[model samples]
Target chain A: MIQVKNVTKKYGNFKAVDDISFEVKDGEVVGFLGPNGAGKSTTMNMITGYIDPTQGQIIVNGVDVGKRPRKAKKQIGYMPESVPLYEELTVKEFVRYMAELKLVKHKDLKEETNKLIEEVGLKEVENKLIRNLSRGYKQRVSLAGALIGNPDVIILDEPTVGLDPKQITEIRDLIKKLGKNHTVILSSHILSEVSQICEKVVIINKGKIVAIDTPSNLEEKTKSKNTILVTVEDPNNKMESIKDKLKEADEIKLVKDNKDGTKQYAIVSDTNVDLRKKLFDILPKEQIIIFELKKDESTLEDAFISLIDDSKETLKDNSQTTVEEQEEKNLEKNNKTKESKNKQKEKNKKGSKKEDKK
Target chain B: MWAVLKKELKSYFLSPIGYICIGIFLLIFSIFFYLTAIQSASIDLGNLYYNTAMYGLMLIIPILTMRLFAEERKNGTEQLLLTSPRSVTGIVLGKFFAATTVVLITLIISLMYFAILMYFGTPNLVPTLIMMFGFLLLSMAAISIGMFASSITENQIVAAVITAAVLILPWFLPNINESLAALDLMNYYSKFPAGLLSATEVVGLVSFAVMFILFTVIVLKRRKAVK
Candidate 1:
């Protein structure tokens, strides 16, 4: 179980993640969907205890991350965004080292290391140095590092960012398999992948969560009209009058004129209406040969774009009011500390030295 | 702590850095061995270690400690270390001891010169061993300083330069002010090389190492909020 309660991360005056809260139930796979700089990685880092939240609490598996970092971290296995690994060490050695760092038992270290190496499909390159491996293999090595000790909560930040299609599917399958026994929180830009592997999604925009629900629910909410596409050989120009003939059809739009002398038309109708059967029966009677007939479905991508646009408009209106209030608060806080860090304005830059001097 | 220490030690040997550092120390040791012991026929082993501690350490300590935390930060491996179920103090000590152990290995190899000194005549074993022990303390203090420098930056070159500056700046402090002469760590080591055990020097070196080690841990802990 993971609970992020009102988590906020501030680098100087910039709020990387602003007042975001969410929860992942045990054995559930939650996907974090967001545009770049949306604080997806920052939230995962806080949950893993990698970076501290400015004003919030992250409890992982019942242990507060800030209060008991070691205990909470022990419950989590984090594969960072950049896929960091010891370039000098081989795959097996790196996994063994991670096992040791994770406080895996001395006796079980070898067996655990071997199992993870095989699980991530790095057996052939187990003895090769990590620097010598390809990006996909390096990614797998990082996953193996995270999986060591069989941590209860697996937090993978952009796990499939850079990979071939085959490799992506393999990793997606691996994550789905992991989701069966362990609670997995993964972030990705791939909406279809999220819909496939994740049971629920938390979509964030500009450091705030715009929507949170199952993929189907979000798609359903954004899906306002039902449209069916029909490709036909209507050389008689009879497609335009078909909307008038079919009383159920609201709009008939000529989608495309194929070079093969066929026309595709989209028939938009009222919600909860199926026009495929009506078109199949009526097109043949009108001497219109049907080439293809299918419903136009609204996918997660459409849901994501519409939600992002909605959030943008809301932000534009709120910016005038909220920016002022936040700046006022930030000014008072900066005056108290006399230290506004000039570093880490870039996204995902880890570790800071400004506070170190103080 | 032991895990980081062991991994760091293995990393040194895996990349030829361990051999490079040992080689540099041995090269410096051989020069001093020839200068003080072979040419002048000085039976005192203290002068050789003292000379090496004065010169050989500045060059070797940076190489041993520059990559300790800097490379980890640069390569993003610091995430793995900091996010693990380990305290900041343990991680710092682990790297500190790892660098100190590299110097220790070179010192153990320096015993070959000591074995050669035994061929000519029996130099007092007690003072030589004490001098060797004091050299370890001085190296520990220097390693801590370099480790502290490494923790403050992600660039290995910057960390090395910072460490070299910190180590070299003290040598000239006494020239600027008579009171500042006490800041020179070599002054504290004067008695150790002369076959004498000094409590004040032991305390000074240990405190120096402790202060920097604590600084490293505090730096890492504070970075959690800002990073």
Candidate 2:
């Protein structure tokens, strides 16, 4: 189990992570989702004890990280943003070295290292030097390094970033298998991947966490309007009048024209209404043959973007109000400077145009 | 600490650096042995060790120590070392002793020179042992400074250059000022050539090695937070 409480990382005046807190229970697979520069990596770094948080505490299995780093760090297996490996060492040698560094018992070191090599599917290349391996193989070598000590908490930062589709699936399956016995925390900007592999998702934006819930719940919460796409053979041009006849339909907009003498329209209604069924029943009564009807399901991608954009707007508003009250004069001066620069560029373009005309 | 020491020492042999350092030291030792003892027609092996320590050590020390921390940091493998369960002191001491062991291996091979001297004439065994001890102490001090230089930078060339400068500068310092002779490592090593184990020189060399080792540990520990 890991508990991160009110952790914040400050780089001078810039805050990389702002007072974020979360908990990962043992045997849980949690995905950290955010856009780039959203503090997912920073939060993971603090949890893994890679860097000290400017404020707050991280406790791993009841041990405070700041008070007893060695003990706390012993429970974490971190694969950093870029998989860093010792290129000089062969695959087998590197894994054994990592086991030794993690203080595995001398008696079990060989057995444990070989087991990790087999587990990560690197047994074939175990004797090869890491510098001679491909990128995917290098990533697996790093994963093998992380898994050698069998630490309870395994933290991976953007683990599948540069992998191909097949390799991504392989690594995802590996993480899922590891999740059976280990508490796993992975961060990525790929929304669909998170929704597929993670049991819970933590959404962050602009150094602050905006939401934390299951992927389905987040997708459900942000879906305020019900939308359905319907394709119909409206030979009598009765599609425009369907909204007026069906009181449940709020609005209907033409989406596309099909080549088979049919038109597709997107119908919007209240969240509680099932417009698909209503459209199927009423459109047939009007002698309109329905070709297709389906409800639009909001994906995790929409939830992520909406949440991040909402938080960014709120931050911009807050900063704007503060600037108006405290630094109006300086703000005005900066705006004037920008305007003059734009005017100078405009004058240069006009001069060039006049020279061409002459 | 044992884990890191084992791997670092293995790496020395796996790469050409280890063989190069040992081979160079042996070559210098053999040349000095002939000039100082065989040509001089003396039974003294201590003078051979003293000249080898003065000339050959400066080059060998940098080669052994240049990549200790500098290469690790450059390749981002320091993250693995720092994040591990091992303490900073263990890691520092591991690399320190590993570099020292390279010099130890060269010293053992220099024994063949001693065997040759014994074949020609009776040599004082105690003084030869004392010279080996003093040589090890001097090498330790130089290796520690070189390792400390490696920890402060990521560029191996810069680390090697800084280490060479540190080892060579104190030799010339005594030439500029008479009082600066106290800073000279060779000055501390002077009595060992005469077969006298000076207590002050032994203490000075050991303390110097320990001070730099501690500095390296502190720099690595502090980098965890700053990095």
Minimum summed lDDT over a 10-residue window in model 2 chain B is located at: B218-227
Model 2 per-residue lDDT tens digits across residues B1-227: 88889999988998999999999999999899889988999989878998898899888898889999999888878878877889889999999999999999988888888788789988888899999999999999999999999999998888889988888888888778889887778888999988998899999999999999999998887775665
Error of 1 at B52 (Å): 0.9
CAPRI grade of model 2? medium
Per-model CA lDDT versus the true structure: 0.91, 0.90
Model 1 steric clash pairs: none
- Fill in the DockQ of model 1: 0.86
Candidate whose TM-score is highest: 1
Candidate by candidate, in order, the iRMS in Å equals 0.6, 1.3
Fnat for model 1 comes to: 0.93
Across A162-244, the per-residue lDDT of candidate 2 in tens digits comes to 88899999999999999999999999989999999899999988889999999999999999889998889999999988878
